[model samples]
Each structure stands twice: as C-alpha cells, then as structure tokens.
Target: MAHDILISGIRRWARLPVAGRIAIVYLLARLITTGLLLLAAHASTPQSRFGLSPSMGQLVLGWDAQWYWWVAENGYPSQLPLTESGEVAENSWAFMPVYAFLAKGAGLGEWGAGALLVSLVAGFFGCLVLHRLLRDRIGSSAAMWAVTFFACGPLAALFQVGYAEALFVLLLLIALDLVLRRRYAPLYLVLPVMGFTRPGILAFALFLGLHGILRWMRRRAEPLPARHIVHIVALGAFATVIGFAWQAIAAVVTGNPSAYLSTELAWRRNWLTDPSAQFVPFEGFVRGAEFWMGQAGLPSWSGWLLLIVLVAGAAALLLRSPHVRRLGPEIRLWSASYLLYLLAVFFPQSSTLRLLLPLTPLWGALAVPRSRLYRWGMLGLCLLAQWIWILCMYGLAQTFWQVP
Candidate 1:
C-alpha cells in the first residue's frame, strides 16, 4: 500500500544521526506550526486574529507586510513620468522585486500570501540542508540541536504572518550548506537570491566564495583532483563578479555607493555618525555600559546578559576540536555574517533580538560543549532572554498592527 510505503520511508531515517533527526523534526514541526495557525484562524472570528481561519492562501504576517500585499495584488510598477514634469520616478531602490514576483506566484496575493508560500517550502528545505551539513561534518546531535533551536525561535514566528526573515534564513542556511558540501556551483546560484533579498548578502556571498577558493589553493599539493578545483574557482568567480554587479546597480540607481545603506535604513545608519543618536548616550565606554544597562528599548540587563553568554560560548566552540575547526567553517560563517551586520548597527540600539534569532544555529552548537554546567547555565539564560524578547515583540507587534 502507498500508506505503508510512506510510513516505511519515514521510519527508515534513524541511520542519519541526531542532527538528521533534528532536521527531520524541524521540517515536521513547521508543518505542525502551520496547522496550529490554520486551526487558530478557523476557530476565531473572520477578522479576529485569535479566532480566524486560514483559507488556502490567506495572509496574517505583520510590519511593512502590507507593502508586499500591494505588490502581490497589483503587479510590478511600470516607470511613468510625472504629469507636470519630465522627471521619471520609477519604483525606486527601496523595495526589491522578488517579494512582488512571489506575491504574483501565490495567485497575486502579495507578501502575506506569497510569503507563506515562499517561506514554508524554502524554510523546510533549509532545515534539511542544515541537517546534511551537520551530519557530514559534525555529529547528527549537534545538527539536530541547531535546527531545533531555529525552529522554536522568533525566526519560526514569521510563519504565522509571512516575513522576509523566513525566506532570508532559508537562503542563508542553503548557501552555507552548499559550501560545506563543496558544491560551489549551487552555492553561487543561491548567493544571487540572497543579494536580491538584502544588499548585505553580497558581502556574505563574496566571503564564502573567497574562503572556498583559498581552501582549494591551500590543498594544491594534495593531488586531490584538478577538475574539482577548476569547478570551484569557476563558481567562485561567477558569484563574486555577479554579486558585486547587482550591488553596483543598486548604488548607481540610488546615486551613491552607500545611498541604499542610508536612504532606506536611515534609523540604522544614524547611530554611526550622530553622537546623540544612540539609545543610551554616554561619554566613556563604562558610562555607555551604565547607560545601556538601564535602557528601556533593550530591557536593560538582557542585552548584556546575551552578550556575555554569546562571547563565552563562541570561544568554547572555537576551541572544541581541530576536526570541528577544519570541517565546519559554515558554523563560524553563519555567526560571523550577522555579527558584521550587527556591528554596523551599533548606534541607537543593536536590535539585539533580531540579531540573535538567526544565531540560533550557533547557540545550539554552543550548547554541545564539554562544559556541561556552563552550557546549561548559558542555555537557561538564553531561554529566559528569548522569552522576554518574544513577549515584548508580541506586544509591540500587537500595538502597531492589531489596533483597529
């Protein structure tokens, strides 16, 4: 029977390892998460979030969510001149084209419906890829924890309302997986998607491509196989060149290489130049610490609490073993890419919660350390921090989007 064959396929996966299990469960949990949302939707009033239902393509995602909806509903913008002038105002560089393309794919539903379609499939694939990378390099247990952590966090929360984070995280994990498997060709292909999604992703694609090249060059005397090296170099060249080209287009259109950085993300960039722009303003580092420790935006102590544990865990994971260091650069790169983004957002506040969500993979890895006491302690701290952040974010989202 087809049912028996399907059940047998599902049951035959124990050979994969803990990471494989986690990866399997991560995808399984997403289905369950979707089901939970659908059930809640049907149980509640049509407009009442707590009592609504999910039609096949309904959308309930939040924040700037409506913009994607507009694109999905209406289709791409055609450039048109103003009625009284010759000035041409195109769609501008503020919005990317992919979300609209997606909206249209979801029967022209925009971001909300399109997001659900994009993320559910993509994020599920992401879990499988993350698991494969871990299984091939590290143990399955480490992979499982990493995938599990991601599935439980704010990253997963995006499933309810369709957000960029879901798609972003999936592409990120896929690109990393390709590198881990030495499948440079597929990695290069995925990088462009990341670049289109966020300008910062060009940096990620370039760095990963470069690392793969240097790795091949270092293995020059091993006599492994010249054909594979040629393939890798070719792929790296494509990603690096093409990735930068797209970024250049964005810069030229915006009239400054960094215009997109500032024009679209004014609040984020203000902290870099303006002294008074910080969430907690103070003179000395110590004074800044004191100010930050008492701020309302970041919950005073939770920010510092996350900082201490994050750094300590990072050091431990780095020192774990030479094998881990050699085979699993994806783990390090995964954390590093976001660190680059967060360090750029040093002013006002770090947007610590958003910065922390994607690092769930790293946190899960850190939890696997030999220092059981320290690991559990840090884990507890992280869980508490995650809880506080979720409740706070839920309140903020509700206030902004749920207000009738």
Candidate 2:
C-alpha cells in the first residue's frame, strides 16, 4: 500500500507543467546544497579561509565572490595594480561587469545578498531552459532526469553562490536555444550580455561558425536559406566582436595594450615554470600537462600522451557515442568548440572543474540510460562528489590546491 502511494504521488508530480516540475526540482536541489554547505561550514577549521563556523554569507561570498563584490563596489581600475616585482597583479579586469552590475542594481543593501538572489533565480531559469533544450532530443522523462543531474551535480554549489557562472549559463542556454531554433535576431541582445557575463562567448562564436559549416554541408537535404546564411555570418561576426570587446575595453581604460592578457596571465604565473612567459595560444594546456605530471613524478612525455588520449576520448564521445549522438549535432559542436577554447587559453588547475560548468548540456548523455538502478547509482555518485568538493574547497581550505 505504501509503495503504491509513493508511485501515485510521483505520477502526479510528473503531470505538473514543466516550469512547476523544474521549480520543485531546483528548490530541492538548493536545499540539499544548502545542507551540504552548512555541514562544510561546521567542519571548517581555523586554518580555512572563512575560519571555524563561518556564516552562509561568508561561504557564498568567499573566493571569487569577493572578486565580484570588489568589482561591484569599485569598478575596474584605470591604472592596473602591479606586484612587488612589477608584473601586473590580479585586479578587477579579470572579472566582467554584467554580473557585478546586475547584483549592484538589485538594491538589496548588501552585495552578497543581491548576488545570491541573482544566482538562485538565474540557476532556476537555467534548469527550465535546459529541460526545454533536451526535451525534444531526448524524451521528457530523460530530460527531467538530466535536469536533476545538473541541479544536484558536483558543481551544484554554483547555483547558490555569487559567482557569474549561474548568470552566464542562463544566458548561454538562451543563446544556444535561439541558435537551434534559427532565430538570430534575439541573439544580438543576448550575445552582448553573455559576453560581458563571462569569458565563453568566443566559444559560442566558434560554434556558430562550425554550425554554419555543418548546415552548409547538409543544405541539400535540409534546404539552407540565404537569409539563414546572412544571419549566421552576421551573428558570428557580432559575437566575435563582443567576445574581444572586454579585452579592448581593458586595454583602453588601463592605457596598456595587454592589460587583460597580463592580468589573466598573472594567475597562471603561479603554475608556470617561467613566470614571465608570454601568452601563447594552445600552449597553456601543454605546459599545464607537463607541470602537473612533473609534480606527480611522472615523465613529461606521459603528460603529453595523457592529454592526447583525453582529447581523442572526448572526440570519440561526441562523434561516435550513441548516447551523445542522441543529443543531436548542435550540442556536440558547442562542446567541442568550448573544449577547444579552454585548451587555447586556460591552464589546468584546481578550478578546471568549475571552468567546465558550461558543458552542462552533456548531462543529457549521462541520463539517457533507463535503468532505475543505474540512474539512482549516478545520483548517489554525484552527491558523494559534491560532498568531497565542498569539504576540500570550503571545509578544509588550508592548502593552495583547495581553491574552487
């Protein structure tokens, strides 16, 4: 009788409108994340960045949240700060203005509260959009399961934090949905906001280009229109311009041509053998591979081999995996382009997983399996991973490697 009652309740829930279902899922996920955060705060030591028994505000506003808050309080510097050795130090230029300014405009009295409000709201809407993005490609049940995975995934803490990721992802999903629907007009507005919200717009621009090529190749069967051709080209150009606009703004404001690049490289310096190394496309990962491998007492060549294997594996998954193919081509193209963008610019480090949050669309592939045991097992693993991440990043933040 109890089992029947529980199944009936779940069936009723499944009948709810998509928005209602997503809202419930998002709320429950936030509650779980909140509980985990409280546990982490309880376990925090004196050596942790927030110290023992830190408040929820402290946990939310810690790490990069402080940087966003700083940007909100004081706009980017006209003259950049320099280290004792005269290299460009970490400054506000590394953070974009959209999330900070939006939080400030919330008028919540405190920046952290406003930032949290924005993140929570954006994350909820992001889940709704994600469900819509996947519903047609996969079945509704599978899509909902994918949404659950994303909401409760290891990086779920992002939904409650002050970081721009939640906002950036919301905008990204809208932009991608627009692209998939072939509605390019709305993207003009979305692209600028997304570009300013975070550093992933270039990948979107690249995806547009790749998408155009794919469409062109399939024109015989799909009937590509001239108007679409124009929209694709124009939108790609506009996205590229917006992508580089931040760098140009930083350079003009700071009166230094390399202000943004120098500031970004400052963070990478800590991991580089040569602190003064100039920015080189596709070099960061190669260097990062060697650096991490050397730290592990492995041959540098092994790192290169591992990098190659990882790249090939990712390619095989996107191009050949039946599960990923079910998501269709646009998602695969976006994932490939974003990974390429990361390889070109980012150094592998503690923040790598956080940086990969934009790939949330791929969660659909993981949810494609229909076995209840498999689904529940994946959920258990995700929750366990979430606990470990919070423990290291917030609870015991005593080491340099514990950074989020």
Candidate 3:
C-alpha cells in the first residue's frame, strides 16, 4: 500500500503543468547545491579564500563577485590603473555593468543578498526557457531530463553565485528560442541586454550570420521572405555594433583607444611567458594549449597535436553525431559558433568549465538516450562532478588552478 501511494504521488507530479514541474526540479537542485556548499563552507580552512567556517554569502560573493560589487559601489574608473611596469591593471572595465547595477537596483539591503536573489530567480527562469526551447525538438520527457542535467550539472554553483552567467543564460535561451521561431524583431531588444550582460554576444552575432547563410541556401525549399532577409541582416549588424559598443564606451571614458583590450589582456598576462603579447584572434587557445601542457610536464608539440585532435573531433561530432543532429540546426550551429568564439578569444584556464556554460542546450542531446540506466548513471555523474567542483573551487581554493 505504501509503495502504491508513492507511485501515485509521482504520477500526479508528472502530470503537473510544465512550469510547476520545472519549479519543483529547480528548487530541489538548488537545495542539493546549497547543501554541498554548506559542506564546503564547514570544511573551509583559514588557508581558503573564504577563511574558516565562512557563510553562504561569503562563498557566493568571493572571487569575481568582489569585482562586481566594486563596480556597483564605484562606477568604472575614468583613468585606468597601471602596474609598476606601467601596464594596465585589471579593473572594473573587465566586467560588464548590467549585472552589477541590476543587483544594486534590486535594493535588497546588501549587495550579496541582492546579487544572490538575482542569480536564483534568473536561474529558475533559465531552466524554464531551456525546457521550452528543447521540448519542441525533443519530446517533453527528454526536455525535462535535459533541464535536470543542467540544474544538477558540474557548474550548478552558478545558480547560487553572484555571477552574471545565470541572467546572461536566461536572456540567451530566450534569444535562441526567438531565432528558431524566426521572430526577428524581439531580438533587437534582446541583443542589447545580452551584449551588456556578458561577453558572449559576439558569438551570437556570428551565429546569426551563419544562420542567415543557411536559410539563404535552403530558401528555395523554405521560401525566405525578403523582409526576413532584411531583418536578419539588420539584426546581425545591430548585434555586431552592440558587441563592440562596450569597447568604444571604455575608450571614451578612459581617454585611451585600447582601454578595454588592454584591461582584458591584463588578465591574460598572468599565464603568458611574454607579458606584452598583442591580442591576436585565435592565438589564445594555441598558447593556452602549450602553457597547460607544459605545466602538466608534456611536450609542447604534444599540446599542438592535442588541440588539433580536439578541434577536429568536435567538428566531426557536430557534423555527424546522430544524437546532436537530433537537436536540429539552430542548436548545432550555436554550439559550433560559441566553440569557435572561445577558441578565437579566450585563454583556457581553470575558468574554462564555467565559460562553457553557454553550451547548456546540448544537454538535450545527452538526454536523447532512453535507457533508464544511462539516464540515471549520467545524473549520478553530474551530481558527483558538481560536488567535486564545489569542493575544489570553494573548499580548497589554494592554487590558481582551482579558480572557478
């Protein structure tokens, strides 16, 4: 009788409205993550960044969150700070203003509280939108499973932190959904917010260009209207403008033409043997590959070979994998575009896992497998990975490599 009652309860839960189901899942995931965080906090030592027995607030507001708070407390500096060597130092210009200012506007009495509230709300909504985005392509069951994987994945810490990723991802999922539906006008509004929310809008802009070309090639079959062509072209141009607008704004304020680029390069300097290397598109990854390989006691040539294999393997998977192909063209295109963007600009480091958050939509492809064992095993792995990530990044943040 007890077994039957439990089964009936689960059946009722499964019958709830999609939003209700998502809310329940999201809440549970947050609870689990919170528990893991608490565990990490208890285990934290004076050696850790958070110190011994730190609170949830401290853990959330540590690392880059401190920068966001600095931005909120004091706006970007009119004059850039410099090192003893006269190179630009990392400053508020490295972070975008949207998340910081929005947290301030939340008026939650404390910056950490406000930032946490924003991340929590945005993360829940992001899951809902993710479900909606994936459900149409894959069935509701698979979509829900994908959301579960996303909520409980390795970077689940993002949902509870003061970072802009949750909000940026919420906006990105909405934008991607709008694009897949061919609703172009809404994107004009979405693009600006997304651009300000994070650094990934350039990837989205590139995806738009590729999407336009793909539509044009299939125009005979799908009948591309002239108005859509115009919308696509205009929206792509608008996104490109927004992508660079921040740099221009930084330049005007600081009275230095390369203010933003120099500020970004400041962070890259930490890992480079030649601190004065210029920003070259696609060179970061190549250098990062060699750097990390050397740190791991491997040959430099092996790093180059590994990078080639990884890039080629990723291309092959996107082009030929049955599971990924089931996700349809828009998702596959976005994934490819984002990966390319990362290779072009980002220097891989401990934060690379966090940077890959934009590819969350591909979780749907992993959910395409229907075996109960496969699904449950993957969930177990995700939870384990999440705990490991929290412990390394928060509990024992003793080295630069442990950064989240």
Who wins the lDDT comparison?
3
- Candidate 1: misplaced stretches above 4 Å? 1-24, 27-59, 70-95, 107-110, 213-237, 241-247, 251-259, 269-327, 341-352, 356-364, 367-387, 398-404
Error of 3 at 85 (Å): 0.8
Candidate 3, 1-404: lDDT as tens digits: 99999999989998899999999999999999999999999989999988899899899898899999999999899999998988998999989999998987884658888899899999999999999999988899999999999999999999999899999999999999999999999998999999998899999999999999999999999989999999999998999999999999999999998999899989987788585446789888898899999999998999999999999999998999999998999999999999999999888899999999999999999999999999999999999999999999999988978889
TM-score of every model versus the real structure? 0.64, 0.98, 0.98
Preferred candidate (lDDT higher): 1 or 2 = 2
Sorted by lDDT (best first), the order is 3, 2, 1
TM-score of candidate 3 to 2 decimals? 0.98
How high is the CA lDDT of each candidate model? 0.52, 0.92, 0.93
Better of 2 and 3 by lDDT: 3
Q: Tell me each candidate's RMSD, in Å, in order.
A: 7.9, 1.0, 1.1
Candidate 1 has a TM-score of: 0.64
